[model samples]
Target: MKMRDISESQRQFALLGGIFAAALVVSLIMGWILFPSLAYARKAQPINYNPPLHVEQIGITCDTCHFFYEDGSWAGIPTLETCVDCHSDIIGASPEEEKFVNEYVKKNREVKWALYVKQPECVSFSHSSHVRMAKIACETCHGPQGHSDPKDYLANRITNYSYVVYDPRVPLNAFTIIRDKGETVWGTMRMDECTACHRSRGTSTACFICHK
Candidate 1:
């Protein structure tokens, strides 16, 4: 081949490489500016929370609704005084509820609840933010708690799924396949589990999201 032709080929190859590099830079810039939430990360928290087991239930429970509230806010956490307001009059009526109130509540012990949903201390997710500020409701992210009851165990399972959910919006095969749903035995939480919510709707997945 002629020297001029060889030189021309080299120039063409260089031009193509330059174009690719420029395109990559543009894509990164666009993603960082337009979708910062996709790359955000929160810190991790390891806690040992052993919740009360009511009779035969495992992983799912009816006590979620046992939550107490006056106007709209929770009393921080469920308390002994909260249980008797409804159970004192009918302790013997429902042996199960009575047993729980008398055994756990009477001793001034708070139920050891393993909270599935959590946000980093540095990164705060206020209920009011998604509610009043964003004009959304609890059910929007939490699903339908009103229709959920002891009989409806699915919602409770989803609630206690640690940090997993069925995203209806995902395409038929678009699932991220997070954690592979460890089936062999007991397990530990993973960063992917944290990223699931963090990456959702552009929430942060940065170290600061969890590490204060």
Candidate 2:
């Protein structure tokens, strides 16, 4: 009777251990699959602007829409007047174009575009220095925006900051290293990435160059 009771207890313990291990495996798999989507809120663009299509038709460059001002400050988002210059009249019969004309152009309101690149308040970036002095192509940092299709923009809901999503064209091998190091890597711009690029180009390494 004593031997039977001991065997029964051992069997129960083994069963419980197996169940716990299985639950842990399932939890890990679920976390791995769902974490990325949960971390980001993939919001669709308010205006369906096909960048690649516009680049082909308009013959306008990226700088045409996003250019540095006379004061050497970057105009991150273009104003409504910029669009009205070419889109005042119904340039295309598309629904998006009609919506733009009626809602924004006629009303003389700027399209509230969600800015993708946002640095912290302490960081100061000069587009004039990078573009004019460094002579960097817009595509180098921003990727081939002219050749890519318009897709949903990603942002962190908690921080209300923009983040960089995985791009097939640009491999994010650094992300793998970040994950391996057990660090919380967001889709946003990382200091390491910026430093790496600067090192490659032999740019200024001074802390004051980027930090305010």
Candidate 3:
């Protein structure tokens, strides 16, 4: 009778241990994999934009589209007015180019390109300071965006921010990394990245520098 009772107790213990282990596995899957997948919903851009194609075909640099105004403010994205200069007539044989000219340019409608990175309203970033004074190339911070395929772009559902810059927790394969001018560049424009860069350059990272 005593032997039977001991065996029964051991079996119960083993069963509970197995159950606990299974629960832990399920919890980890939900937390790490399932949750993130559900959180970030993929969104499509208003129009298919091929940056590399434009750069290759037209030989136009990034500044041609995103130039600085006379007041030293950065032109974040080109408006229809800017694009109309080239796109008033269909310049490319691609169907997308035709669609763009007819559907948007002819109708005088803006393409409404999705913003990949937008600084918070409280933060003030001087592009001229970084691009001109610091002499940082656009690829240094923005990665090889100029060389990237537009189809690779993804956005977050909750914040409407670019997944490339905002959600760094995703798999490494999701982010595009490229080597430019002997420097490896990838996206993840978080505070830590900025702080690390500042620390490397011995630059002042006072709260007032970023926040108004």
Most accurate candidate by TM-score: 3
Candidate 3 has its poorest 10 consecutive residues by lDDT at 173-182
What C-alpha lDDT, on a 0 to 100 scale, does residue 84 get in candidate 1?
53
Q: Write the per-residue lDDT of candidate 2 for residues 77-129, one digit (tens) a residue.
A: 78987878788877768898898888889888888876666777888888888
Q: Model 1 compared with the native: what TM-score?
A: 0.37
lDDT of each: 0.42, 0.69, 0.70
Query: How do the residues 1-212 of candidate 3 rate in per-residue lDDT, one tens digit apiece?
Result: 45445677889999999999999999999987787666656665778777777776668898998999888899988999999997889985988889999999999998877766666677788888888789999977776676755454445556554634212333322223222211332433657767888889988899888788
> What would the TM-score be for candidate 2 when compared with the true structure?
0.81
TM-score of each: 0.37, 0.81, 0.82
Candidate 2 residue 31 Cα shift, in angstroms, is 2.3
What is the lDDT for 89 in model 2? 77
Ranking by lDDT: 3, 2, 1
Clashing pairs in 2: 164-187
Please estimate how well model 2 matches the true structure, expressed as its whole-model Cα lDDT: 0.69
Clashes of each: 11, 1, 0
Instruction: Put down candidate 1 lDDT per residue, 1-212, tens digits, no spaces.
Output: 65455677888999999999999999987765544433322212221112233223344433343433444443333455654564454344556565566656666566554343444334444343344455655444544332322211111222123332233332111022232332211122345654675587576667754556
